[model samples]
Target: MRILTVVGARPQFVKAAAISRAVTAHDQSKGDLEDVIVHTGQHYDESMSRSFFDGLGIPEPRHNLGIGSTTHGRQTGLMMNALEDIIDLESPDVVVVHGDTNSTLAGALVATKRNLPLVHVEAGLRSFDRTMPEEVNRVLTDHVSDLLCCPSSTAVDNLEAEGIVDGVHLVGDVMYDVLLDDLATLDSMASPVDSLAVDPPYVVATIHRASTTDDPKRFDDIVHALTQVATTIAPVVWPVHPRTSDLVGGLTVPDSLHLIDPVSYHEMLLLVRGARTVVTDSGGLQKEAYWLETPCVTVRDTTEWTETIDAGWNSLTGTDPDRIFEAVDNSSAPETHPPLYGDGHSAGRIVELVRSLPH
Candidate 1:
């Protein structure tokens, strides 16, 4: 069986790593699986894109549709057009996509239009906020996917509530699968924070969502909150995103808050694993913090991964200074993190399910 896998962003690369390893093992044992990778150049920077491929040992993309940064509509349109051509050329048995980026939407649309089966990993996630582009992408992608590989029971419930019962499977999270497999390698990687001369017992903070960065006032407030948390609770190590850096130019950054360039995937895992508290707006980070048994203070009002909140591992603060400080000040991981996601075998299950489908 031949499968065309689509990924564009940093997070998708992490998700792809687990499944790629599974594909390799399947090919060696079964000798019938052939998978091709297609990279949409949504995240073009080496730190965000190429480094992840190198760090995770993901095979080089067979086709790179270089659709770099642009307006959402234009980017999606270009990806759909480019993918349509690739789909016709390769004509794989199935097209598999990950997460809720513009690339995911484009791949789903093209695959469905071409009458090819679509498999959406990380499906059935919902923030229930239509204003967020990711929420829209997730909802639409789930509706059209021929197989929905969900990470949690909560995600499966979300899909069932939407009346999407067909083709849904609780395959657990591919990210957790990678985390378990890569923890030793990540531990061996040198911590960037160690060289920065920052003290330990620090909080790791990251803010890069459009909802916060695109709005100057919101960005300012989040920065102010981090500053307070750094001074009052603990020092903060922030790996600033390029988008956030552009807006934060000329703004006063507190000494307690150490701003550093983004690190590789392994570096980030080490930093978060050792952090006293994690404050971020990134969806993946919330789960990472939870998995690492670190308390997380989310800087957003809503999160698609509500399981963390229910599990008492995550707290929402919504960019408010007082709330952010309070959440971080009282942050603590749950006594028992009842095994969420899966047991590091989700990728094998996903590949098996896709292989079972009729060509």
Candidate 2:
């Protein structure tokens, strides 16, 4: 069995790493499975892309479609056009997509159009906000996927509510599978936060989501709120995204708000694991913080990972200064964090399910 995996962003690489490792083990034992990685190059920077591949030991992609920064329609359209040809050339048993990036949407459209079976990891997630592009991508991808690998029972319930019962499996989170493996190596790796010179009980922040940073006014407000958190609550260490870095370079940021270049995948997980509180709009970070038992103050109003919120490990504070400060001030993770994502074995299950697909 051959699986063509599509990935274009940092988070997808993390999730794909788990599946790739599972495929390697499967090939060793079963000797009948091949996994082809196709990187859309949505995040082409070395920090965002290459570092993840190197850190996670993901095999070099079979195809790196250099679809860099662009308008959404152009990015996804270009990916679809290029993927159609790749699909025809490879003719794999199935095309697998991860998360809700433009690349995921593009891969799903091309695979379905080419009459190929599609597998969507991280499916059945919904913030119910149509205005967000990710929400649209997730909804559409879930609808078309031949197999929907859900990370939690909540996600499964989401799919059932959408009347999407066929081929849905509770395979847990592939990211959690990777996270568990990566956490073990944290002791060997030099802490990514060590260079920042911040002490313990410091906040770790990543605020590069478009909803929070695209608009000049909103971005300024969020930066201001972060400044306040740093001033009164605790120092903040931010691994700045390239796009967000450009915007922040012009702003008057505080000394307490330490900004640094993006770190590798394992380095990031280490930082999150040790953080006193996490502040971000990134969906994956929210879950990582919950798994690490770190209190998270999400800058977004709504989150698809509602399980974290219900578990009392995450708080939403929508970029408002008072709310942000308040959430940060009161951020305290619950003593008991029930098993949310999985048992760190989703990759094997995902590969097994993919193997079951008819060619």
Candidate 3:
């Protein structure tokens, strides 16, 4: 059996690492499971893209579309065109995609149109907002996919609500498996951010969502809130996104808030592990915080990971200063996290399932 996996963004790369390892580890009697990786240049920056592959020990992609930044339509279109060529050339038994990036949708559309089996990992996630491109990508991919590998029971419930029951399996989250395997190495590595002169017990904040950064008032409000959060919380360590840094250059920042360029994956994991609380609009960070048993105050109005909020470890503060302060002040991890996501074997389960398919 042969699997062609498409990945673009940073989160997708992290998720793919686990599954890639699983495929390499497990043996099949029918034949060797052949895995091919394609990288769409959605995240073009080295810090955001290549560094992750190097740090996580992910093999370099076989095919690189080089579809860098552009309008959503253009980027997806370019990926489809390039991926279609790869599909025709490789003609793999199954095309696998992870998460809700433009690459996921493009891979799904091309595979389904070509009549190849499409397997979607981390499927059935919904923020219920049409405005979010990710929400649209995930929803569309799930409908067309031949196999839907879900992360949690909540995700399964969401797919059932959408009337999609067949070909769906609760395979848990691949990211959790990566975290479990890499946590020891991540902790042992000295954080690159330590040289920036920020100490532990500081609030780690990352603001890079389009909803917040694109709007002037919303961005200002977030900056103001962080300033206020710092007055009470002391030091706020923010690993500013590249886009956010452009906007922040024009604004005056308080000394209490330390703004630095984005850190590597292991550096980030170290920072979040030692932080007093994490403030971010990133979906991945919210889950990572939950896994690390750290309190999180999300700056977004809605989150797809509602289980974290329900468990009382995460608070939705949006961009309001008062709410951000209140939530951060009251943040605390649950007494016991009962092992959400999986027991770090989700990747093996996914590979076994894919192997059983009559591809």
Per residue, candidate 3 scores C-alpha lDDT tens digits across 3-93 of 9999988888888898888987874443588889999887767656777888889798898889998889999999999999998888799
Clashes of each: 0, 0, 0
Which model, 1 or 3, shows the larger TM-score?
A: 1
Clashing residue pairs found in predicted model 1: none
Candidate 3: clashing pairs of residues: none
My TM-score estimates for the predictions, one after another, are: 0.97, 0.98, 0.96
On TM-score, who's better, 2 or 3? 2
What's the distance in Å from true for residue 50, model 1?
A: 1.6
Q: Considering TM-score, where higher is better, how would the candidates rank from best to worst?
A: 2, 1, 3
| Candidate structures ordered by lDDT, highest first | 1, 2, 3
* Candidate 2 lDDT tens digits, 100-173: 99999999999999889999999999999999999999999999999999999989999999999999999899
Query: How much is 144 displaced in model 2, in angstroms?
Result: 1.0
Error of 2 at 180 (Å): 0.6
lDDT winner, 1 or 3: 1
Candidate 1, 220-330: lDDT as tens digits: 888888889887878899998866777666767778888888778888989998899999999999999989999999999899999999999998889888898899888
Model 1: how far is 105 from its true place, Å? 0.6
Q: What is the lDDT of residue 43 in candidate 2?
A: 75
Give candidate 1's error at residue 207 in angstroms: 1.3
Off by over 4 Å in 2: none
